[model samples]
Target chain A: MDFKLKIWRQKNRDDRGRFVDYEVKNVSPDASFLEMLDILNVDLVKRGEEPVAFDHDCREGICGSCGLVVNGRSHGPGRGIATCELRMRGFKGGETIVAEPWRAKSFPILKDLIVDRTALDRIIAAGGYISSKTGAVPEANSIQVPKPAAEEAMDAASCIGCGACVAACPNSSAMLFVAAKVSHLALLPQGKVERKERVLKMIEQMDKEGFGNCSNNYACEAECPKKISVTHIARLNREFILAEIS
Target chain B: MNKFTALYRSSVGKKIIMSLSGLFLCTFLVVHVVINLFLFKQDGGETYNRYSEFMSSNPFIRTIEIVLFAGLIAHVISGTLVWLKNRASRPVAYEMYQLKDNTTFTSRTPMLTASASLVGFFLVIHLRTFWVPNRFWETAPQSNYDLVAAAFSDPVYSLFYIVALVFLAFHLRHGFQSGFQTLGLSDKQYKWLIDSVAVIFWLFIPLMFAAMPAYFLWFK
Candidate 1:
């Protein structure tokens, strides 16, 4: 198969980037999106041209590293999948695909199709962890987590720290990601100890990061690869209110 | 910043203010629409003027009026802040963003749509045409219906009012459920019910409002 790819290219953070279109021919239908990029990069290298750069690791959608706004939707088209999981068969042979980096004020472009996503790490570092006594591993039955709470916590925990939620957001808000972490831990008994300060500090840090606020458009939910529910956002709001009042 | 200042400055805090003030304004629309319906009574605006008189003179209602304005102010302030900050969050524009693929068409941003810029503009003109003349200019209760009918008489202003009501429908279409989502009450169970009820406020209120002007302009 053959396709036209409009790829973004930049030297570094200070450089102004633009979309440079290229045509790739004779690609396998079964290749993942990243593998297709690899084929293009090999061709570019053979021709003594700079290859397009993007982040990817597991190629299995679990790493949360590979991200792109393909044809306008984050993580390519459809729902519940990452860019790495996108297959060439999803597109027509002669399709013109526009691949752009995640655009957010906080996530600056480090190179072509690569963004500085450390801001997300800073948000997680703010309070996404629970403090527990370091000792022998406790018995599994000791925690006594309820079934519903466990399900909620597990669901929230599925978030892979991917910034697709941010990329897909109209406001570029990280509320969905922050809410996922907040709700996940807040539901567990172990996460209850620092619930109040945790949410407060995390939100303060999120504000300092210069990301936008949630307009409740649910675009983040729509674009999320894990299909992270917006219900966690509601939980985050409830948690914030309870923490403020109590 | 102090605790309250910090809270108010945060995005979540500002949204809390937006939701509360927006819903307050939404409630005000209901009361205003329901009362305005009295204009259609066959008694030639007698009942409409009576309620209008009571609303104007009663100290309690007047006090509530002040609170209502306060809510509007708060809502506008937070909305403006959200729009400004969110605008700053995306300095670079996308070369090809098919927003329709991912999100609904109702103002992709909140304040840009639901939070009121057009509706606010219509409101200033609306109050100048009717409320100001009725309240401060000494247009007595007897002339109240005359005030409304006379204003709706102008084709341009009447058309503008109706156009603005359409935008209000677009506004509330997102605002009603959005307010619930912001309040953290957006449980899956509540969403179906909240969304169902939301259609009424977003549609009914505006249709009822637009009907008045459309009625007076063409039929009356």
Candidate 2:
């Protein structure tokens, strides 16, 4: 496959960015999207040009690092699939693909396609965990958490904190991300200990980080690579209410 | 803190005021419609005049009037704040928005139409005839029927009021459910039902109100 690419390029966080065009010829349809980008980067480096910088680790789609707004959809045209997992065969030959970083006030660009997603990590660090005692492991059967509750917690815990939700949301809201972390922890007996403080602290942290409010648009779920449910958001709302009331 | 500041401080704090104010306005609309329905009664003169006098003179109703005015101000302002926030968040406009794919027209149009109707020229006329005389001037104007009939007698006035009511219906359709959601009255099962009922009632009722004025102007 031969493809034309219009990719966003910025020298630094301070520089105003614009789309720069490139063409890659003789690309394999079986190659992943990132693999094609790798081919382009290799060609650029061979020609003594600065390579396009994008974050990626564990391209198996677990690390949640490789993400870009491809053709106005986050993580590319495929539903519930990351950019790393998206194969080049999805596109036709001689196609022009537009790629850009997630345009958001909170996720500032560090370089071309590389955004500082430390804000998401900060939200997690605020209170995305249970305060378990640092000691020898307790007997697993001691707590005896209900199977349904454990299953629900595991489901909510699947969030990889990719910031795709923020990218997809028209409001640029981080509600899904915040809600996922909150819901996962709030459902467990271990998490129930700090439920009140966790919700209050995390919400305060989220607000302090300059993320926007949820518009209930559900675009996040549509674009999420993990297909994380919006039920997490409802659970977060419930937690926020209970925290405030108690 | 002041009344406005007190209402703006917290999430629950803001929404509690919004719900109370919205519910009050909802009550006001129902009562207003009921009073207007009296005009359709056989003894239009006596019923309209007596209802008007009862509304004006009753001490509890007078207290409720003061609160209603406050509620209107609070609801509009808080709702506007939410609207502005929602608008600011979505700074980029789509090529075209299809409501069916995303949200209801009632959900999107209220803050928009309400803002327009609140500030528009016809609303000024509405205030001059209904609000200003009733509230500030302390004038015992003609019967409510006469006032409504006179306003609707002009085709332009009738059209404008009908348009405003259409907007109001759009406002109420979403307002009812949004109010319930914000007030934490929404549960998973009942939530969709509440939203559906809100859409039906507001859409139907406002059309009914508009029809009365439209009928009197065109036919009577």
Candidate 3:
């Protein structure tokens, strides 16, 4: 298969970026999207041209290091999978795929299709951790959690911290990402100790990071690589209210 | 900033205000629709005029009217602020984007709020025509029914009312469910119920309201 690619290219954060078209021939249908990019980069390097730059670490979807708005979708067309998981078979032989970095005020483009995502890390740093003093490894069964509560907590914990929710959202709201972290901790008994403070600080950080408000659009959930539910956002709202009242 | 002020300044806080005020306004719509339904009674508008008079004269209902106006103002202000902030959050626009899978027409269009805001202009026209004359101005008209009938009989005013009601319907379709979600009332257990009620409210109320102008313009 072959594809004509219109990929956003930039030298640095301050550089004015624009889309540049290139053609790739003889792509394997089984090759992942990132692997196809690897082939393109190799071809570019052999031709003594600057290779297209994109972020990817784990070819597996779990690391959340890889992302691209492939043909106008965050992490390509499929649901519940990252960009690295998208295969060339998803496109036809003569398709023209457009790729770009996450377009948000907070996520500045560092290079071609690579936006700085440290804003998300800053939000997490605000209150995403439980402050438990570590002395020894505690027994796993010692702090028995209810089945439902544990399940809900795990579900919320499924978020891989990818910025796809922001990339896909019209308003660039990070509510789903923040909500995932907030709800993951809020649902657990261990996390309930600082739930009020946690929600407050995390939300404050989220606002300070210049993310938009959630209006129940459900775009984040749809484009989420992890398929994180918007119900977590509801829980985050409940938690924020409880935090405010208390 | 103080915690209260800080909370109100946050995105989630603005959303809470929007939901609370929007839900308050929805209640007012239900009451308004019920009162206006009296227009359909073929009794020469006696029942409708009496009801309108009672609504104006009664102190309790009058006090609630003040709250209703406050709710309207809050909804408009918070909604605008939120919209502006959301726009600023995405300074760069996508060249090629498609939202067919994840979003509904109402959900995707940020202009729904603008449509609702346009209803504000219609509200001013409506109030000047009906509310002002009915409430304060004695020389304008003696009966509330006569005033409403006279206004609705005008093609221009009736057309505006019908158009505004259509926008209001689109606003309510998204606003109803959005209000529940923002208020944390959309739990998994009752999400279906909330969604169903939103669909009914958005569809039924606006159509019923539109029917009033249509009725007076043609049927009556």
Native contact fraction of candidate 1? 0.76
lDDT of 3 by residue, A38-72 (tens): 99999999999999999999889999999999988
What ordering of candidates by TM-score runs from best to worst?
3, 1, 2
What tens digits encode model 1's per-residue C-alpha lDDT throughout A1-246?
999999999989999988898999999999988999999999999999999999999999998999999998899888899999999999999999999999999999999999999999999899989888848988999879999999989999999988999999878899999999999999999999999989998888888999998877888998899999999999999888888778
lDDT of each: 0.89, 0.74, 0.89
Better of 1 and 2 by DockQ: 1
- Local distance difference test, candidate 3: 0.89
TM-score, chain B, each candidate: 0.94, 0.80, 0.94
Reference contacts preserved by each model: 0.76, 0.08, 0.72
Give per-residue CA lDDT, model 1, range B1-220, as digits (tens). Answer: 6767877988888898899998898889889999999988889899998999888889998999999999999998998898899989989978887777766677476435553779999989988887887778753554788888988989998999988988888888888888898889989988899988898899988999999999889988
Question: Residues A60-173, candidate 2, lDDT per residue (tens digit)?
Answer: 888899888887777887777888988999999999988888767778889999988898988889998877784888889988888977887887787887888887776677
Error of 1 at B156 (Å): 2.0
Candidate 3 per-residue C-alpha lDDT over B1-220 given as tens digits, one digit per residue, 9 for 90 to 100: 7877877898899899889999998988888999999999999999998999899999999999999999989888888888888889988787677776778877765557667777889889989888888778867546888888888899998998998888888788888998988877788899889988887678999899899999999998
Sort candidate 1 into its docking category.
Answer: medium
